[model samples]
Target: MNQTSAARPLVSFDGVSKHYGSVVAVHTMNLEIYEGEFLALMGPSGCGKTTSLRMLAGLEEPSEGEIRLDGQRINEISSIERDTPMVWQSLALFPFLSVQKNVEFGLKMRAIAVEERRQRARKWLERMEILELAERDISQLSGGQRQRVALARSLVTEPRILLLDEPLTALDANLVVRMQGVLARLQKELGITFVYVTHSQSEAFAMSDRVVIMSQGRIEQIGSPKAIYRSPASRFVADFVGANNILSGSITETGEDLKISTAVGEFHCEKNSDRDFNTGDTLDLVISADLVQISMEGPEVQNSLRCRFISEEFVGSIVTIFAELEDGSDFKVQARQRDLANMALEEGAAFFASWNAADAHLIGGNGA
Candidate 1:
C-alpha cells in the first residue's frame, strides 16, 4: 500500500485465461497492478491466484490473451528475462549452499562477477539482519531465519516487481506478524510494485492498497479493503472477504430504502452497490457481526430478530455471541467485552437481536 497516486500499471492481464485439458484454471482476467503498490490476489485453493502469479513470472504461459509489463507483452519471454522475482512459500533455498551463496544464486546464474555478487549478497543479508549467518549452512537456520534468507534471495536481484506466493504461510502466528511488518517496511522504503497472492483476507486487508477477490477462476471484485468489506459487489465476495451474516430473500419493496422478505422476517436494507435491483428480484442481505446489537428487554432498532442466546465466546477485547433464530438459523453478534457485561447474558435465554438499516448491505444476487 505504498505511494501509488497517479501511478501507472507495472503489470497488466488483458483477457488472460489458462486451461489444462478440459479444466479452465483462469478465465479471462482483465486487471492492472499499479507501480509502487502492494496488490493482493486472494481466494480459495485452485482459484488461479498462484496460476496468475506464475504466468506473470513467465513460469507458465497464458493459453489465451496477453500479459504485459510496462505495456510490453511478454507471453513469449523466458523466466530469466522477466524482471519479476518471486518469494515462494517453500523458500526453495539450496540445502547444501551457504546463506551468502544462496542469496547470490540469481546473480551467479546471470554470470555477475564473483566479487560484486558477494558484496551485493552481503549488503542484502545485512539489511535482513542475517549478515552473521552468511557463512552458515541452510539446514543450520531456524524457520524465521530461513524466511529472511528467502526474502533476501528474492530481493537481491533488485527486481522491478516482487511477486509473493503465500511466503508467510509456514510461519507461526507471531513470526507471521513480524514478517508482515518486515515486508511492509521493505515495500515502502524500496517503492517497488508488489503482486501478492494469499487466501487470508486479514493479511490482504492489512498489507495491500487494493485487493482482487477471485472465485471459481474468475474475478469477483476488486477494491480497497475498506470498500470490499463495507460494500461487497457480490454474495461470494461478502462471504469470502469477512464473517458477514447473509440472509436470502426476495425484494418486497425498492426505493430509497429497500425491503426484503426472508425466513427470519422482513428486513429493511440499504444498497451496497450501484446496480439497480427491481421488486421480486432475489436478494442477499449482508450484515457484519459487529453491527448486530442485542437487547435483553426489547427491540431498540428497526430490523430486529428475537432469538435465544446459545453461547458466548470471549476473545481478547471482543466477545462473540452465538444465537439461533426462531427458524433455527444460526446468528452471531460481535461486541466489546464491556458491552457484553452490560447484557448479563445467560444460555437459552430469549433476547432481541437488532441492527440499523444503514449497516445492512443488500446484494441482489445468488450466494456462494
Candidate 2:
C-alpha cells in the first residue's frame, strides 16, 4: 500500500521498549500512526501486540525509549488525561446501571451538567442504534447490544484516539461480522485514530488501513493486509498471514529471473531476485494454498509438481486438498468443493499442482 503524504501521523513511537523484570515484552520499536487511520496490531498470544496497545492507552509505560503524540512526548501522560479511550474485550459495563446511565458515566466524571450529560448520552446511544435499549440494564442486553453500549460510553467522551482490545472476541461468528461493520462505519464517520489489537487475521484485515504483525515481542512486518498476504517479508509472516506451502530449495541461477532447484523439481520464481538470493544461495519458497491449482493432467506452467493426494477437508464453501510430493514433503491446495468434485479427485489419485511464477515468494535463508 502507498503511504499518504497528506495525512501526518498523530502518534509516533521512537525506540520504544517495554520489559517485565528481565523478560522483554516489547523490544526497541519505532512506528508512526497516521491520523484517523484504522491500524490493527495483530499477532499470536505473547507477541506483545496487546502490551503495545496497552502502552498506547497509557495503561503501561515503556521500560526504555519514548512515545510521542503529534510530536509531543506522552510517556508520562496518565490514562485518563490522554485524549484516548479503551474498549475492553469483556465490554466492561455496569450491571446495575441502565445503558443511558452507563454511557453518561464518563460525562458525569468530567463534571458536565446533569441535564447536558443526559442529552449528549441519549444522542450517542441513539447514534449507536441502542436508543431502544436506553433504559435496559446490561444483563438484559444481547452480546451485540452490550458491545454497542460499551462503544457509546467510550465515544461519548469524544476522544481523539480509540483503543480496542479484541472487542469482538466474545461474539459469535455472525455477530462478529456484523460488529465489524459497525466498528468500520463508526471509525470512518468519526475520523478518529483507532488502534485495534486482535489475534484474528480476518478481523484485522477487514477493518485496518495497515496491519502491524508482531512475533516474539518484535515487529515482523508492517503493511496493508493485501501486501502482507501477497508478499510476506519473512517465513514467519508467510506462515502466519495465511496457509502457505513452504518448499525448501537452493538458487541455481539468478538475475532477471531466479531458478530454484528443490527435491520436488526445478522451478522459476519471479520475485525479489535482486536482493534475496545469490546464484548459489538456498531459500524457502512460500506459495499460498489458494494460489495452487490442481489438475488431473500436467499443464504447461512455469512451475508444476506431481504429487499424490493424502487427504481432503471440506470447510463449508471451500475444500482443502492435502498432498505429498515425491520426497514426502506435504503441502495443501485450496479449492471449491464444486471444483474438487468436478475433478473427481480421490485420496490416492495422482495430480499436478501448479502456480503462476509471480505467485511464488522467496523467504528466509538456507537454514529456514
Candidate 3:
C-alpha cells in the first residue's frame, strides 16, 4: 500500500454521481485524494474527467452522494468558499490587465487590501520566476509566462488544494515540457494537493504521483502510472494506455503454467494470483510493444509471431514498428533506433516478433 493511502484522505468522493438531466456525467465515484499528492484525472473527451474535477471544485453539484473535505461534507460549498481555485485551459487571464494585476485578481476577489494583495501576488510571481514580467500586459507575455501568471493567481490564496484543467495545452512542445517541470517542482515545493485533468497521457504519466483512468463517466482504474501501464485492470485501460497489443484467445491449459490458443499460435503466460484461470476459458493476452523484439529470424522465445512490417514511427531515440499479424490484427514493437539500425526493415517485409512469457499479461480471463 502507498504511504499516502495509509494516511487519511484529504478529499473524498463517496458514492458520488453527477447527472445532467438524462445524461450521466459521473457515476458512483468513490475516490480518496491524499494531502500533498499530485493526482491526475486522465481519459479521452467526454470521459467525465473534467466533470469529476469540476465537481470537486464545486462548479458542478453531484446528483447523489457526498463530496468531503478534511472529513467534513462540502458538497454544497461554493467554488470560492471551497478554496479550490482552478487554473483553466484558457488561463482565463484578463487580456487588458497587467501580469501583476492578473495575479492579484484572486486576492482582490476575496476583498484583500490593495497593498497586501499586491505583495502576495508579487511574492508568487517571484516564486514562479516571472517577477520581471509582472508589470507587462498579458498579451505582451509569452504563453509560458501567462501560464505562470495564472498559476500565481491561483496560488496567491495559498489554498490547500489546487485544480488544473489542461493548463499546458496551448504551449508549444518545448514549452509544454518546461511547464511540466515547473508544475512538478511547484507541487513538490508547496506540498499541497494538485488535482489535474488532462487527456494527454504523457502529461499525466510524466508528472502525476497517481493517475485515475475514466471512461464514459465511470472510474476504470486508479493507480500509479507505472502500475497502470504495466498491469492494466481492464481492456479499456490497456487500449487507452497505448503501446499494448491485446490478443483475444481461450485458455488451453491452466495452473502454474497457463497456455492460451490464439489465431497466431499457442502461447504460455505466467499465472497471476489476482485471477484464476481454467481450461477452455476465454481471455485476452496483453503484451507491451516495448517488451517485444523483432528479428528477421525467429528466436527461441515463449511467445513469437511472424508479422509483416507495416510502418515504423520515429520519435527521438525510440522507434516503433507497426506490423500485421497472421489474423490481420495490428502488432507493435518499440525499440531503440540503434538496436534496429543493422536490420534491413522494409514495408511489407516479414519479421518475427517475440517476447518471454513473463512479459505477457492476461486480462478478461475467468475469475478476473
Candidate 4:
C-alpha cells in the first residue's frame, strides 16, 4: 500500500450496486478514494466505470448499499449539496454565454453575491491561464479554451472533489497530452481528490496515481500504474493491460523456484509467498513484452523459446516484433528500432526469445 491507501479514504463505495430492472450496471463494489489523489476508473465501454463515477457525483442513486463522502452517508444527498462537481465529456459550456459567465454559472447557482462570483471566476480563469479569453464568447474560443472554461465552472465553487468523465476525449492527440499535464498539475497544486473516468489506457496510466480496472460491472484490479503493468494480479488483468504474454501451464515442481511445464517448453519463476502451489496445479504466467529479448542465437537465459517471426510494429523509436512460439502461441518483443535493424529479422525467420526467470510473474493457483 502507498501513502494514499494508508490514509483514511475521503470517499468510499461499500457493497454498492446499481441496477435497472433486471440489468445490472454495477455490482457489489467496495472501493476507497483517498484525499488529494488522482484515481482513474478505466475499462471498456459498458464496464460500469462511468456509472461508478455517476454514483459518486450523486447523479445516480445506488439500488443497494451505501456511498459515503468524508465519512458521511451521502446516498440520499442532493447533487448540489454534495460538494462533488462533475466535468462532462461534452464540456457542456453554454454557447450563449461568455467564457467568464460560463465559469460563474456554478457560483451563481449557489446564491453567491454577484461581485464575489465575478472575482472567483476571474481568479480561476487566471489560474487556468485563460484570463484573456474571459470576455470572449464560447463559440469564438478553441476546444482547449472551452475545456478550461468547463474546468473553471466546475471548480468555481471550490469543491473538495472533482469528477471528470472523459473530459479530454474531444481534444486532439496533442491537446490531450497538454491537458493531462494541466489536470495533473492542478490536482497536485490544489491538494483535492480527483476521480477520473476514461476508456483510454494511455490517459489513465499516464496521469493517475492509482488505476481501477473494471470488467462486467466488477472490479478486476486496483493498483499503481507500475504495479498493474509489471505484476498483474489475474489473467484478465494481464490480458486487458495488453503487451503481456500469458502462458497456460501446470506446475511440475514446487520450491523457491517453481518449474512449470507449458506447451512451448519448461519454464521457472520465483515463487510468490502469498500463493501456495501443489504439483499438477494449473496456472498462468505473465511476461511483459518489453522484458523479452530476441537473438539470432539462443541466449544464456533461464527461459528461452524458438519462435518464428510474424510481423513488426513501429512507434517512433520503439519497435514491437510479433512472433509465433513453438506451441503456435503469439509472443511479442519490444525494443529499440535501431537495435532491431541490426538483426535484419525477416518474416518467417526463426529466432530465440529469452528472459530471466525472475521476470515471469505467476497468477492463478489453488491458493492464489
Per-residue accuracy of model 2 over 1-368 as CA lDDT, tens digit each: 22477766788888999999999999998889888889999999999998998898899998988998888889999987786788998878999999999999999989999999999999999999889999998999999999999999999999888999999999999999999999998999998889999999999999999999999889999998999998888888988998899998888887667899998899988865456567778788999999998899888877999989999888898999899999998989998888777786777889999998888988876433
Residue 139 error, candidate 3, Å: 1.4
Per-residue lDDT of 237-317 in model 3, one digit per residue for the tens?
A: 999996999999998887678989998899989886555677998989999999998889987777889999999999989
Give the range where candidate 3 is weakest over 10 consecutive residues by summed lDDT: 1-10
**How many pairs in model 2 have backbone atoms within 3 A of each other, for residues 3 or more apart or on separate chains, i.e. clashes?**
0
Candidate 2 clashes between residue pairs 3 or more apart in a chain or in different chains: none
Local distance difference test, per candidate? 0.89, 0.89, 0.91, 0.91
C-alpha TM-scores of all predictions: 0.94, 0.95, 0.97, 0.97
Ranking 3 against 4 by lDDT, winner: 3
Give the local distance difference test score of model 4.
0.91
Task: Summarize candidate 4's per-residue lDDT along 251-328 as a digit string, tens digits.
Answer: 999877899999999999888556677999999988999998889988777789898999999999999999998878
| Cα misplacement distance, residue 302 of candidate 4 (Å) | 2.3
User: Candidate 2 versus the native: TM-score?
Assistant: 0.95
RMSD per prediction, one decimal? 2.1, 2.0, 1.5, 1.5
lDDT of 1: 0.89
- What candidate 1 gets wrong by more than 4 Å, as runs, is 1-6, 271-277, 365-368
Worst 10 residues of 1 by lDDT: 1-10
